[model samples]
Target chain A: MSTTGGAGSTALVTGASYGIGADIARALAARGHDLVLVARSAGPLGRLAAALETEYGITARPLTADLSTEAGLEAAAGAGLGLSFERTAWEEERRMLALNVVAPSRLVHAALPGMLGRGRGRILNVSSVAATAPVWLGTSYGASKAYALALTESLARTRRVRRSPVALTALVLGHTVSEFHERAGIPPSPPSLTLGSPYVAERAVRAILRRRPPVVCVPSVRYRVLAGLLGHLPHRIAALPPLADDFTVTSYGAPQPSYGTGEPPAGGPESAGGDGQDGVLPAEAHGQRERQP
Target chain B: MSTTGGAGSTALVTGASYGIGADIARALAARGHDLVLVARSAGPLGRLAAALETEYGITARPLTADLSTEAGLEAAAGAGLGLSFERTAWEEERRMLALNVVAPSRLVHAALPGMLGRGRGRILNVSSVAATAPVWLGTSYGASKAYALALTESLARTRRVRRSPVALTALVLGHTVSEFHERAGIPPSPPSLTLGSPYVAERAVRAILRRRPPVVCVPSVRYRVLAGLLGHLPHRIAALPPLADDFTVTSYGAPQPSYGTGEPPAGGPESAGGDGQDGVLPAEAHGQRERQP
Candidate 1:
């Protein structure tokens, strides 16, 4: 929570087995935080925690929990992120809601009181540019992020939290190099459109540690400009048929026939667990994991 | 869903036993649309349905359902609206989410395909200024509405929905004279800040029936202006302690100390179901209700 990096504070990073969450865990550990690393994959989480503990000489606990379920939520929970760029089934959408909305919400609700009482804490929620974009191709994903962004902003602006030292930030992330797209069946964006997890994580941590942390944080300059335009442009112009069509094809792959129907994808919810814009590693990343701090 | 109001088409209204929902049902009925009214109180819903049928010569079917429970959601669903302006318990917050977020989402998800397939329909979601406002006193209410607003906007802008005839509108209502405040235990706003249900309902229906319905609708001119301002203002200025304090006192009454704690209010969720911004009548309004076009 302090500007001097993690110090004696403990940082909990969910979806920490891979990608941005793992990088963030590394960043926080380097800054001297005791870590609780959470992800559905126990092996990766355990390895990440042990590596962080050894490298940073700080305590690191690995917790495996699928935050989409009630019991999972009760066990541990953020970096709650997932998105099906194409229209997915209601069940998948519900799972996305549980991860992207309910999990973070429950975590924040649970954490806020103690943070307020201590008067020294920081809660950073990883959101997406979808939260700000005027035009979105899919259902529920943007809505979920909007919930996260609004929740963080609303709580940050409240009299009690604002007066106190608790810094609440919603990192409105754009495309980052992660397994999210592959896992969700979304075609990956061009390399130019993506940011590295290391850089994004650093900026995210910095945003939360600021004197007056921003309610909405967009990591890179380009994405910040894009987010600004997307947020303010009139819907008519933003959703221009050609522009929207191009975005649809480029970002979401192709329009699936099963969109309107509530048909489950081949693997269902279990297969698509890597964090969306916020970062989570795919199962394969565990074998070839690289740890650099 | 049609520009001509009712005809042979059916419009489903949730929380229809009271306030805005009842008024809207009346408006739709007068316009000649058959109605499916959903609410928790069977008595009030039945009465409203019968009266609408008698007066408008339109089919009015009342279905009693809470919409905050799985059973309730399965039975019927909005007009999803409710808010505890003062910070309430987590249980209350969860209920608010169920009513405001889950209910509308389920309804829209259930209805969209049929509407799209038919190539004609309208879905109006009741949101609030809180969805756009930077400063909020409560935890989940504004966040929930933000989800509603984002969902509406996102879906409306999607290629399939855009090309189709279905109109999706999120009504960003301002202060209205209803039993919502009393039920939620928040003091009422000044009469000047409040708009009546009849006027609001008429405007809401008009918005949905338009050739190109707005993604977001604020009925009153003054509120439209206010919504514009609130949506754009910087957080530093918006959350200026004194300004926010005045707003908190005027809009939400005094701050409650039990905010952080998940303490159940005296009456719990059962007592407070009057729609916050979109309108729902208290139990008393049921007995002394006046039917007007």
Candidate 2:
């Protein structure tokens, strides 16, 4: 982007407390753009905003909201779009949909008109490579990402016909070094699958401001290729993608041996799918402790 | 599938009041399996159950419950699996996730144990070809189906390891003759793109019962081929799929040039994806209310 038109415009960044979202915020700030940072944690968001403001001399405002409830969505809609969900917990899954799918949509609905009215706006919806071809054991998360990508394209197409200059891009990402895996109770990503969060953010930022961005932009050249390949594969995604080694539910209700005692992985075509199924497992009951959607 | 083992076993079917679900129930009755037919409407479910029971000389039970809520899911737990959702309505979308995604997972989670202990069980999760590759404009509907497919595969994998003998299959379908489109207010499906719901059910029943049934089974041979091709294509599905023309938001909040003067389709690569600048565009929001869950 040309610094002239980019500066002074307000950008809204969700999941801005850390990782890719924070880096995107920093990249936006570097272009002299003011920002509204959104995330569940207040302290981290505030600190990130302060750091960006101090470093780039741009105003940065922080808003803490759980992007996973109707009210949170209204607050954020009035708001990356990250994804997380549980197999056993439907309520958690509901909130997961709220955060990953609904929140981005509502935010886009809320932000785009203003951007269009102002004559320039950029909406970058962060999605996953998994959307192209789902990873094993990643039901709600991958599906939700797919929803994000399709909706982004749908809106982009909707606006394109009107010759609206406003831009919408789905930032399709691969495994990045972030808190995602840790939060999901999965092991850390191996080196080969790990893409640096900063690198992903920088590329995403550039694409969003390009003269004409593709409807979907996968960050790294390698990830882009992988995305294409995954999309080509049929439903039988035999093995886990490099980034998805930890994506499967290895140990669910019980701690199963993920590695071999000569045993295949828990859900590895052997260990029986039920986590003691009876009538809505008590652990997965509605009022159970749900994940932070 | 031996007559000895299949005889007298109870079969549970959801969305059984109409379309494929009803057909599947009929097919199950033909196979001599007693039935538990579920749907949102009680009258139709009861009538279908009665008709099937009388024709096939088997017992049938009707259960009417909206499987789109926590209470509904809990009520339907230990039940059948089917999916549907809308793109624009958050309320509908939320319920879609609950029904298409939540209901299936919970049903499987509930039924799997008893199926395992009995050493003989069959779960046929009805998904769509759209899940293999999403048709444009069908956002949440497609995503929820993808979730159903992945989660089904996940649990199937989990059980395969234990030599549990319980069988799970995803019935991947194509556009079929049904009330889905009429209810959604979209025009009827074109003949070339349409498949008969009875044909779909018959095939689904065969595949689910056959030894070594595929984890994901597309009903018709042509649909199977089409499903394969869709899976092969990366995103940027060049044109709106044959099934996708009506998938776009046709009526939002106001009147737009739909038929004449040829305004490119409402979501025709522009309009920035239905941020719904105005109200009830007639092209999408309500008359466009569509589903086939």
Can you list each candidate's DockQ?
Answer: 0.46, 0.19
lDDT of 1 by residue, B1-293 (tens): 35334366777777676666777778878878888777666787898899999998988887766665777774233322133333344555555566666666666766676676777788777777767866444356677778878887877777777777766777776666635446445555556657886787888877676777777878899888877887788867866643232222345443343312322121111122323322211110111111111
Residues B1-293, candidate 2: write the lDDT tens digits: 33122667777776666555666667878888777766656676778777887899998888766665666663331111111112233443444455555566566556655565566677666566645654544344454455556655644544231245556676665666534344334454566657776776687777767655567777677887877777656545533544344233455332222212212112210011111100000000000001122
Report the first chain's TM-score for all candidates: 0.80, 0.75
Q: How well does chain B match by TM-score in each candidate? A: 0.80, 0.76
Instruction: Please name the candidate that would achieve the greatest TM-score relative to the true structure.
Output: 1
How far is B217's C-alpha from truth in model 2 (Å)? 2.1
Candidate 1, clashing residue pairs?
Answer: A18-A281, B6-B33, B18-B281, B19-B280, B19-B281, B20-B279
Question: lDDT tens string, model 1, A164-254?
Answer: 7776777777666635456445555556657876887888777666677777778889988978888898777877753332222344443
Q: What would the per-residue lDDT of candidate 2 be over residues A80-181, giving only the tens digit for each residue?
A: 212222223444445445555556655665555555565566667766665666453333445556666665665565423225556667777666653534
How accurate locally, in lDDT, is each candidate?
0.59, 0.50
Q: What is the TM-score of chain B in candidate 2?
A: 0.76
Regions of candidate 2 where Cα sits further than 4 Å from its true position: A1-5, A75-91, A109-120, A138-140, A157-163, A178-187, A233-237, A240-293, B1-5, B75-89, B112-119, B154-164, B178-185, B233-237, B240-293
